[model samples]
Target: MQVAPRRTGEWWISPAIPAVANAALASLWAFTAFGGWGEQAFCGVDSAHDPTCATGFENAVLSSLAVVIPAVVIMVSALVLRRVRHYPDRLGMMLTAAAFLWVGAEGIVFLGGYLAQPS
Candidate 1:
């Protein structure tokens, strides 16, 4: 008979669930965020003719800020909370930090694309 591992006291919940869910969400965001999907969706294919459409520069800046700011906040939170009383769910915290790092990477790529765009 196969034996199951003993359950630990504090962290009964598995970290993989949230980690996978977040990963999936991040991927969806990446798929939609790049290639001017937001602008196209909001202003249609001919965004230039749409008076309501924000400039590409504006969209890029806002997108960068949106991800980067949250990434900073999540990173800060993970570091700050890590110093407190020994946390049981270290794996969960690490996964959270990893997710934000992914976001930070996306933000960097977005910034690069933004800079490359013609004014």
Candidate 2:
């Protein structure tokens, strides 16, 4: 889960980590779509006639709001849970691991995208 700072000014749940994860996932998800998936459906959201912000996964920067919102929810919820009793420590670690996996896969795709081009 999430752990809030204990009397510290710093936020225990880092936004950067999740932001990076979001970027990676969004990029991978978008690039995979290529010409077909873009402007279609994403995150179970129906995007019809909307391109700029129509649930399209074209760019992570553009999709940051969509990704960050959920991540922040989870982080905040986890932090609240951390304040309460009976919270498992592995939860946060598992999510973090999943994020890493997502980043790794996206990194591979990103590399392929660049290397596949003729420079």
Q: Please, what are the lDDT tens digits per residue for candidate 1 over residues 1-119?
A: 22234475432545555467456746655664655554444445553545334365346545565565565565446446645214536755665765766666566545644453444
TM-score of candidate 1 on Cα atoms, chains taken together: 0.44
Poorest lDDT segment (10 consecutive residues) of candidate 2 = 36-45
lDDT of the candidates, in the order given: 0.54, 0.46
TM-score of every candidate: 0.44, 0.37
Best by lDDT: 1
Error of 2 at 95 (Å): 0.4
**Model 2: residues >4 Å from true position, as ranges?**
1-86
Superposed on all Cα atoms, model 2 deviates from the true structure by an RMSD in Å of 11.3
> Model 1: which ten-residue window has the lowest total lDDT?
1-10
